[model samples]
Each structure stands twice: as structure tokens, then as C-alpha cells.
Target: MLRIKGTIGDWPVDLTVEMDDADWARLAQNLPVNVAAPTAAAGATPVASAPVDQLWLAAQDLLRRSGGTEGPQLMSELEALAGSAGAAKGLLVRLRHSPKVKIEVREGVQVFNWVEE
Candidate 1:
């Protein structure tokens, strides 16, 4: 299980998405418009396993439309995506809004640890 975690504004959220390498390759090979390819890796695991790019893209898209507004709407969308993925066992989201947020990812059901300010 691969996890994709991040914040939408002042809300910290985590998303668990299936990390199907095949699917990731397929998707990456055929990434949609405006969707940048995941960071390149030379190892057996393709770039799809890294959800940071996707999360960042999604956040940027939402923020671009926020008109500089800061709130929880983006966080809500991220949470919905996590639930939609149907692999999240637990999640921790904190809103610190300290001009920067921290993100950490690891193996085993993926871990998304971040502080949202």
C-alpha cells in the first residue's frame, strides 16, 4: 500500500493510494495534460510510487484557484481522495500555517506526516 499525504491550506491530511507499479507506469507513460511525470528513479520501483509530485500538483492547482485564500477547502479535497483510495488506516493532519509545512513519507502503507500552517 502506498500513501500520498500533504496539506490543502491550514489542514494537514494523508492519502493512501494503491501503489500498483504497473498502473503507475501505465499512468506515467500516459500522464494527462498538465500532469507532470513523477520524479525519475533508476531503481526497480518506477516514479509512480512517489506521491509527492501528484500531491504537490493537486495542491498547486487548488491554491492557484484559491485566489490567495487560506482555509480548509483544499485539505477537504485531499482527505476525500484518501478515503476514495480506500487504503488509509490512520492519518494525522495539523494546521500550523508557519509559512511552510513539513512532509515525510515512508514504506508500509505509506506515511504522510506534515504540519499545515
Candidate 2:
């Protein structure tokens, strides 16, 4: 059994998932066991290695260079950079929440702008 409790925006979420041995086995089959998870020491910033971090930096650079971009166009560029829709969307979500990025709606279209510090 797996329990997930969190908030989506202002809404509360509590979820529970259950799986039998076969289900677990099937799920595990699709996951890579060789890759070790990244870890951070106490009081230190967590680090994500390669492609993930590189992709994130590139995503930020893309926004910075553009000054501001429409939401869908940014997603398309990120998808090309990350080489997968899932990875692209992950970067987009991170950008949306980042302190360095600002979101606004321009003429009914969502835009992402880099916030200079």
C-alpha cells in the first residue's frame, strides 16, 4: 500500500494505492535498478546529476533568451530539448514554480517570463 497526502493549489488531497505481488513485480520490471537515487547531506543543497540538471539549465536559458514566451510554444521547445513529452512537462512545471520565472496571461494566452534578480 502507498499513501499520498498533499495539496493541489488550495485543495487537499489524500490518496491511497494498493498493489499485490504481481502488480509490484510488473511495476518494478519497467523501472531501472542500476541507477542510484541522488542524495543530499544535511544542511546542503540537493543535487541532481546530468541530463536532468542540464535540461533544467537549458530550459531556464531558453526562457531567459526569449525574455518571455507563450506557454504552448515554450512547452514545444522544452519537449524538443528534453526529447520526451514527460520530461518536457516536468521542466515546465518546475519553471512555473521557480522564483526566477513569472507567469502571466497575455491576451488570453499564458506566458512565462524570466524574472531578473
Candidate 3:
């Protein structure tokens, strides 16, 4: 089951979706899989994967290249880049808190700008 509660244009929204096992399997099939196994040398601890770091760098680059991007559009692109809505939202939250990024409201829409150091 998945529950989404939010507001759209000042209107409240509550949604719930239930899925069976087969539905879950189908959903899983569409998700990206990290197939690479972690490896370490003898007596060495396996290092944690840093795909999020790479994604963060890429997200910054995207903003840098765009100069400034509208919030919704940027989120759509980020979702595509991150391969998951959760990851994309996480990146968006990080960007919101990043000192290198500036957020502005224009015509009631958010615009994210990259602050070059």
C-alpha cells in the first residue's frame, strides 16, 4: 500500500494505492537494479557505495549548466537523473539547504540558481 497526502493549488489531496504481490513484482521490474557486488581486498573493509555522491555532483552540474531552473521542471529532470522519485526529492531537499544554491520566487514559482564559488 502506498499513501500520498499533500495539497495541490490550495486543495487537500489524500490518495491510497493498494497492490498485490504480482503488482509489486511488476513495479520492481521497472526499477533500476544495482547489480555490482561490493568488493574488498583481504583484511580490508568494503567501502560504502557512493552513488548518491555522484548524483549530488551531477545535480550540481545540472544547475550550474542551466544557470537557473524552475523548481518543478528541475525536479522532473532530477527525477529522471536520479532514477527514483525518493532520490530526486532527497536531492532537491539537499539543494534547498546547500549554500551554493539560491532560491527565488518568481510569479509564484520557485527558481533555483547555482551560486558559483
Candidate 4:
């Protein structure tokens, strides 16, 4: 028998689990094994960023400068960078769905927030 008494997340808990030698032997079979982590060298250099990734980064930067931006304003900036309304629209769609972006409405206007990395 294994007796455990403790408090978890502000709640007091008391638990008793009974197991024979055979039960303990079977428990080991159900347990998961852990893999060791690979160690990096002491002076590892960071990987360089690809140019394509920079476009999204630049968009986020523009949002940061504005502290959050409306859809039209952001599209305008994207158009300036992409050199075409179609290309800018594609980028806008990508930005809208990106994990780093937060979309909201302010005064009936859709605003996009660039979350910090």
C-alpha cells in the first residue's frame, strides 16, 4: 500500500493506493520511458533568418509602431512592401491567421495586434 497526503492547488488531498509485488511489476510495464536531451556546444551560433520570414517580421514591426492597426491601414503598408494589391491581400490573409497576430474590433473597425515573440 502507498499512502500519499498533500495539498494541490489550494485543495487538501489524501490518497491511498494499494498494490502487491505483482501489481508493482505490472505498473512498470505501463510507465513511459524518457529520452535524453542532446547537448549543444557551449558557443553555438544562432541560425540566420531567411528573407521570406522577414516579410512577416516587417509586418509585425509596422503593427508595433502603430500599437495595433486597422485592416485597411495594414493592407496599405503591405501593398507598399509587396508592390501589388493582390500580393498585399495574400499577405494580409496570412497575417490574419498567423499565431502571433490577434484580431479584434474597435469602434466597429477590425484591428490587428502583433503579439510579442
- Top candidate when judged by lDDT against the true structure: 3
Ranking by lDDT: 3, 2, 4, 1
Residue 70 in candidate 4, Cα distance off native in Å: 0.8
Check candidate 2 and list the clashing pairs. Answer: none
Query: What does candidate 1's lDDT look like per residue over 32-84, in tens digits?
Result: 22334445446656544445346444444444444332233435554553443
Per-residue lDDT value at 50 in model 2:
46
Candidates sorted by TM-score, descending order?
2, 3, 4, 1
lDDT of 4 by residue, 1-117 (tens): 556799999999999877654554354333232222223358986455433344545555667777788998899987787556765665676667566789999998889998866
User: Between 2 and 4, whose TM-score is larger?
Assistant: 2
Candidates in order, TM-scores: namely 0.27, 0.59, 0.59, 0.52
Q: Kindly list the per-residue Cα lDDT of model 2 for residues 47-100, writing each as its tens digit.
A: 645435545667788899999999999999988776677767666876786779
Of models 2 and 4, which has the larger lDDT?
2
Q: Locate the minimum summed-lDDT window of 10 residues in model 1.
A: 86-95
Q: Please give the RMSD to the true structure for each candidate, in Å.
A: 14.3, 11.2, 10.0, 19.2
Which of the two, 1 or 2, has more TM-score?
Answer: 2
C-alpha lDDT of residue 49 in model 2: 50
Off by over 4 Å in 4: 1-50
Ten-residue stretch with the least lDDT total in model 4 = 31-40
| Deviation (Å) of 24 in candidate 4 | 49
